[model samples]
Target: MNFIQKEFRHILRDTRTLIIMFGIPIVQILLFGYVISTEVKNAGIAILDLSKDQATIKITEKLTASGYFKIIKNLNSFDEIEEAFKQGNVKEVVIFEINFDKNLENFNSANVQLIADATDANTANIIVFYTSSIIQNYVNEQNKTIKMPFEIKIDERMLYNEELKSSFMFVPGIMAIILMLISAMMTSISIAREKELGTMEVLLVSPLKPVQIILGKVTPYFILSLINAVSILAVGYFVFDVPVTGSLILLMAETMLFILLALSLGIFISTVAKTQQFAMMLSMFALMLPTMLLSGFVFPIENMPVWLQVICQVMPPKWFIIIIRNIMLKGTGLLYIWKETLILFIFTAFFILLSVKKFKIRLE
Candidate 1:
C-alpha cells in the first residue's frame, strides 16, 4: 500500500503524466468522433443536360436536393466534363443524351451516363451509390404516376449500423488506442524513469520480491488505465451513440484482459529500455503505429497485402479490435470470440513470462 501510494504521488506530481492520462483520450475521442467520417457530403459534380427538357431538369433538381451532391457546373460539352475532373472540382459527371425526354416518352427509356473518378475507389463507390439511389427513387416516383409496365426495386438492409455511421467504426478503434497508450506507454515510461533516476536499483534491493516490485510499479497504472478506459467508453456511448450491444460485464472483462496484456508488454519494454526517452520512442513506434494502422483501426486488414496481413496477425490490437467489434457491433458472446480471447491470453502470458525472466536476470 505504501509503495502504491508513493507511485500515485509521483505520477500526480508530474504535469505530463496528468495530461497524457486525461487530456489525450478526450481530445482523440472528440476529434475522431466528429471530424473523421467516411460518408460523403456535398460532393461536387457536373451535369451535361443536352435534352433541355422538364424530365432532365426534374432529375437534376432531385439529385441536388438529395444533399449528397452539389451541381458545381452545368457543363456544355464532354470536354468540360473531363476538365472538371482534371481540376478536381468534381467527383462525378452526369450526361443526358440528346432527345432524352423524347426517348423516355416514346420508348419508356432514356440514355443517361454516369462517369465517376475512380481514383479513390471507396469514395467513388459511395458517390455513385448515392447518385444512383436518388435517381432511381425519382424514376420510381415518376413511374407511379405514369404507370410504367415494369419496375425493379432494391431492398437494402444494412445490419449493425444501418446508417453506416463512421463513429461506430472509430469509437472502438479510439478505445483500443487510448487503452494502449495509457497502459503500455505510460507504464513503460514510468519504469524507465525510475531506472534512469537509479531508484529502481534501490527498490530491487529492498525487502520486495521481483514480482512484488514489478506489481507495485504497475498497479497504480493499471487502476488509472481502467479509469481512463471507462471514461472513454462513457464518452463514446453518450456523445457518439456508440453502443455495447453485448453484456457490459463481458465488455469490461475483455477490456481488463487487454489492459493486462498492455501492461505486460510495457514491463517487457521497460526491461529493455534504459532511458525514459528510449522507452517513449519504442512504445510510440512499435506499439502505437501497429495499434493504429495494422489493427484495422484506420485501414481494413482485408485490403492489406498478404505479407502485411501476416504481420498484423501478431499485433495484439488486431485481435482486441476483432473481439470488441464482435461484442459491440455483432453482439456475439464468448463462444464467438473464444479464439481471439485465447490469443490475447497467450500474448499476455508470453509477455509476462519474458518480463519475469528478464527481471530475474537483471537482479542476478
Candidate 2:
C-alpha cells in the first residue's frame, strides 16, 4: 500500500504524463470512432449532362439529394472532365448521352457513363458502386410506372489507376506516415537525450544562438531523414510499382520541405519535453496517431464529419499526402497542387519560428 501510494503520487505530480496517459486515449478513441468508416458520404461528383432533358435533370436531382454525392460542376463538354479531375473537385463524373431520355422512351434503354478518379481505389470502388445502385433503383422505379420495360445500363471507367491498385493508394499514405514519424521522432529523441544528460546546459552556455543551436541539432537528422525518404521511394517504385508521374525534381524538393517541417516540429517537441522518454511518447502519440488516423491515409476524409474534416486540414500529413498523390498518381504539376504546397510551407515556417522561440526561452 505504501509503494502504491508513492507511485500514485509520482504519477499525479507529472501533469503532462498524466494527460498523455489518460487524455490522449480518450481523444484518440473518439476521433477514430467518428473518422474511421467504410461508408462513403458527401463525395464530390460532376455531371456531363449532354442530354439536357427532364430525365437527366431528375437523375441529377436524385443523385444530389441522396446525400452520397455533391456536384462540383455541370460539365459543358466531355473535354472538361479531365480538367474537373485535375482540379481535385470531383471524385466521380456522370456522363449522360445526347438522347438519354429519348432512348429510354423509344428504345426502352439508355447508357450512363460513370467515370471515377481511382487514386484511392477503395473509395472509388465504393463511390461507383453506390452510384450504380442509385441509378438501378431509379430504373426499377421507372419500370413500375411505365407499361414498357425501361432500363439504364452503367458504363464505368476508372481514371488515374486503371486497375484500381491498392498500392496506388497505400504508397503515398505510407510515405507521409513514415516521413513524419521517422524525422520527428528521431530528432526529438536526439535532442531530449542531450537534455537528459545535461549536455543541453553546456550547449546553452556556449556562444551559439538559439536558431544556430536548433539547426546544428537537426541538420544530422535532416540528412538522415532525406536518405530514409529516398530509400522508401525506391522501394515503393521497384517493389510496389508506384510511379513518379510528375517531375522528379519537384517531388524531391517538396520532400525536402516536408523533412524540414518534421525536423522543426521535432525540435519544438524537444523544447517542451524534459526527458527523452517524454519526448518519445509525445512524438509517438501526438504525431503518429494524427498522421495515421486523420491524415486521410488510412481512411477517406470526405466520409468524415465536417468538423473532423476541419481538424484533418490542420494536420500536416494530410496536405503532404494530397500533394504526393497529385504528383505521383495524377501526374499533376504545381498548377494543380500549389494550394497544398503553400499550406505545407506555412506550417513549416510556423513550426520553425515557434521552435526557435521556445528554445530561446528554455535555454535562457
Candidate 3:
C-alpha cells in the first residue's frame, strides 16, 4: 500500500510522464471515436443527367438528401467526366441515359451507369451500393402505382483500379507510414542520443551554422530514408503489384521531399527532447499515429469529422500519401500533385526553421 502511494506520487510529479500515461490515452480514445469512421459522409460525386427530366432530378435529390453523397457538379459532357475524376474531388459520376424517363415510362427499364474512381476501392463500392439502392428504392416506389414495374439497371464501372485490389490503397499508405516513422523517429533518436552522451555539446562548440548542423545530422538519415522509400516502392511494385503508372522519377522525387520533411520534423523534436527515449516517444505519439490514422492510410479522410479533416490537411503525411496514391494508382503527374508537393515543401521549410529557431534559443 505504501509502495503504491509512493509510486502514484512519483508518477504525478512528472507532468510530461503523466500526460503520456493518462492524457494521451484519453485523447486517443476520444479522437479514435471520431477518426475511425468507415461510413463515408458527403463523398463528392457528379451527376450526368442527359435527360435532365423529373425522374433524374428527383433521384439526384434523393442521393443528396441521404447525407452520404454530395453532387459537386452536373457534368456537361463525357470529356468532363474523365477530367472530374482526375481532379480528385469527384469519387463517383452518376450518369442517366438519354431519354431516361421516356425509356423507363415506356419500356419499364432504364440504364444508370455508375462511374466510380476506384483507387479507394472500399469507398467506391459503398458509393455504388448506396446510389444503386436509392435508385432501386425510387423504382420500387414508382412501381407501386404504375401498371408496369420500373427498373433502374445500374452498370458499375470502376475506374483507375478495375480489380479493386486493396494493395492499390495500402501500398501508398504504407509508404507514407513507413517513411515517416523511419525517417523522423531515427533522426530524432540519433540527435537525442548525441545530446544524451554529451557529444552534441562538442558539435555545438564547433564552428558550424545551426542550419549546417541540422543538415549534417539529417543527411545520413535522408539518404537512408530515400533508400527505404525506393525499396518500399520496389516491393510494392514487384510483390504487391502496385503500378508506377506515373513517372517513376517524379514519384521518387516526391518521396525524397517527404523524407526531408520527416527528417526536419525529427530535428525539431530533438531540439526539445533531452533523451533518446523521449525523442522516440515524441516521434511515435506525434508522427506515427497521425500518419497511420489521420493521413487517410487505414481510413478514408472524407469519413472523418470536418474538424478532424482539417487536422489531416495540416499533416505532412496526408499530402505525401495523396501524392503517392495519385502517381502510383491514378497515373497522375506533377500537374495533378503540385499542390500536395508544395504543401510538403512548406512543411519541410517550417520544421527546418522551427528547429533552427529552437536551437538558437537554447544556444543563448
Candidate 4:
C-alpha cells in the first residue's frame, strides 16, 4: 500500500509525464473528432464563359446555390484559366464554348470542359463530381426548351482520385506521423538512456568516436521505422485497397530518406538533453507536435493562417506527406515531386550535419 501511494505521489509531481499519460490521448481524440473529417465542402471553382447569355448566368447561379462550390472568377477568355489554376484556389474550371446557348438549342449538345487541378487529387475529384451533378441538374431543367430527337447524357470521370477512398487520404499521413514519432521520440529517449545509466560514459572512454556512438544508437531504430513504414503500406494496400499508383521503389526510397532525417533529428535532440525525461519532452514538442499539426495530417494547409502556412514549409513531414500523396494517389513521378524531394533531402543533410557537430562538441 505504501509503495503504491509513493508511486502515485511521484507521478502527481511530474507535470510533463502526467500530460503525456493523460493530455495527449484526449487531444488526439478531439482532433480526430472535429478536424479529421473526410466530408469536403465549399470547394472553390472558376467559370470561363465566352457565352454571356441568360442561360449561362442561370446555370452559374444554380452551381453556386448547391453549397458544394463557390465561383471565384468569371473569366473572360481561355488564357485566364491557366493563371486561375496556378493560384491553387480554383480547384475546378468550367469552360463554356462561345456558342454554347445556340449549340444547345439547335445541335442538342453544348460543349463544356471541366478542368480540375489534380494536385490534391481527392479534393479535385470531389469537386469534379459535384460540379458535374450540378451541371446535369441544370441541363435537365433546361431540356424543356425544345423537343429534340436525340438526348445527350453526361458521364463524369475522376482523373486522379478515381475511387475517392478515405484510405488513400489517410495512409500517407499515418505513415508520416507514425514514422516520425517512432524514429524521433523513441530514438532520442533510447540514446539518452545510455547517458542516464552511464553506458555512454563507458562508450566515450572506448575507441568509438561520439558520431559513431550516435549512429550506433540511431541505426537500429531507423531500420525499425522503415519496417514499420512498409508494414503500414501493406495494411493500406491489402486491407484498405489503397493502391500504389506510382513507382513503389521511389516511394520506398523517399520514405527511407525521411526516416534517416528523423533519426538524425532524434540524435541531435539527445545530444542537447542530459536526461531521458528532457529528451522525451524535447522530442514530443519539436518532432511529434510539428509532425501532427503542421504536416497537413488533420487540417488542410490551404486553410491555415498565413503565418502557419509559412511555418509549415519548414516542417519536413509536410513535404513528405505531400510527396507521398502525389505519388500514391495521383500517380505522379519524380518530375512532379522533385522540388519537395529536394527539400526533404536538404532537411536530412542539415540534421546530419548538426548532429555531427553537436556530437563533437559534447565529446569535448
Backbone atom clashes (below 3 Å) for every candidate: 0, 0, 0, 0
Candidate-wise lDDT, in order: 0.82, 0.79, 0.79, 0.75
Cα shift from native, residue 11, model 1 (Å): 1.5
- The numbered model that scores best in TM-score is 1
- Relative to the true structure, candidate 1 reaches a TM of 0.72
In model 3, the worst 10-residue window by lDDT is 28-37
Q: Which wins on TM-score, candidate 1 or candidate 2?
A: 1
Model 3 steric clash pairs? none
Off by over 4 Å in 1: 37-168, 361-364
Q: Compared to the true structure, candidate 3 yields what TM-score?
A: 0.57
Clash pairs, candidate 2, are: none
lDDT of 2 by residue, 149-267 (tens): 88998999999767563322466776676677667876787678777888778867877677766766676556656766676677567754568899888888898999899988998
Model 4 worst lDDT window (10 residues): 28-37
Q: Tell me the tens digit of each residue's lDDT in model 4 across 1-364.
A: 3423433454457676456434543354334333433434677888888887776778788888988788898898878978988887887888777777777777787766788776665566657667777778787766666467323244443434444333226778878877777788766876677789887777778877766666666666666677778877776677546679999999999999999988888888988887899998998899888888888876677668999999999999999998999899888999999999999999999998998888743444
Looking at model 2, residue 312 earns an lDDT score of 94
Give all TM-scores, in the order shown.
0.72, 0.58, 0.57, 0.59
Report the CA-based lDDT of candidate 4 relative to the real structure.
0.75
- Which tens-of-lDDT digit does each residue in 1-364 have in candidate 1? 8888998998999999999999999999988766633346788988888988987899899998988889999998877776788888687888888887778777777777777776554456567667778878877888888866423232332322233322235677887898899888998999899889988888877778778878888899999988988898899889866788997888889999999999999999988898999999999998999999999887777768999999999999989988988888789999999999999999999999999888753543
